[model samples]
Target chain A: MRMDRLRELREAKGLSREGLARVAGVSAKTIEAHEYGRTSDVSVSIAYRIAAALELPLDDLFSASLKAVTLKEAV
Target chain B: MRMDRLRELREAKGLSREGLARVAGVSAKTIEAHEYGRTSDVSVSIAYRIAAALELPLDDLFSASLKAVTLKEAV
Candidate 1:
């Protein structure tokens, strides 16, 4: 879901994960994790940086409909 | 800072911390932490839920300029 969209966005911008990471001032691993949806949650700050690098609004990269399991739900 | 904005938004909407949590389906502690900037990172998923409950865009609650300490910086 997120992984596919992130990959599409990155590719659309002609950026590799490493390239996006550089522009976003984050580690390539972080970009990779986001692309793969490896992390359980994405920090708001990270999303902001990636959106800035991609030159898009944060909501575009992550849609409002994306559901997440809250800690209340987990417990 | 992120905390101030979130706190202001919630208050302006006539929502207490616990009330916002109930609306957002997250723990009250989670809302409190975010209001206080206690957490180092905010999950994008959580942000989406809160934004929905607040009836605002995610970026409004958390500005794009709210910088975070990236993992690379932490290491």
Candidate 2:
């Protein structure tokens, strides 16, 4: 999936791809590719690692806005 | 950021990490790591790749739930 937030967050944290890769037990190439939008396919486990690295909740990384709805009382 | 949705979506599409990697121009290892929660740091460009490969909107891939708020009518 897309990761614009991931990149922004990483940069804000001053973490290099290599450094993040080392911490996450992934390869620099992998990190590089992901950083470059080279892949969408990923596993739940990996998502967890990334979330842990970013110190963000898993839901925060993959959820979106909800549709708005209004309700009215019935007579 | 986490990618639990990515994993679920990819699997639903019946694509392997290698297959997605090829399409996204990323290495299989990268996909694997991302799937296994091995990395949190990523670039915006890479996020685009993953989104493209998955055929999902960029916003869908990284956006999360919003905080709920209720307002009261003023007198």
Scored by TM-score, the top model is 1
* Model 1 Cα lDDT, one tens digit per residue, B1-75: 244378888989999988888888778998888777787666776777787788887778754345444323422
Candidate 1, CAPRI quality class derived from DockQ: acceptable
What does candidate 1's lDDT look like per residue over A1-75, in tens digits?
143367788999999998998888788998888777787666666777787788887778854334443424532
Candidate with best lDDT: 1
Task: List ranges where model 2 is wrong by over 4 Å.
Answer: A1-75, B63-75
Q: For residues A16-35, what per-residue lDDT tens digits would candidate 2 score against the true structure?
A: 88777666556677667656
- Which portions of model 1 show Cα errors greater than 4 Å? A1-4, A64-75, B1-3, B63-75
lDDT of each: 0.71, 0.55
For model 1, what is the error of residue B69's alpha carbon versus the real structure, in angstroms, after optimal superposition?
Answer: 9.6
DockQ (C-alpha based) per candidate is: 0.39, 0.03
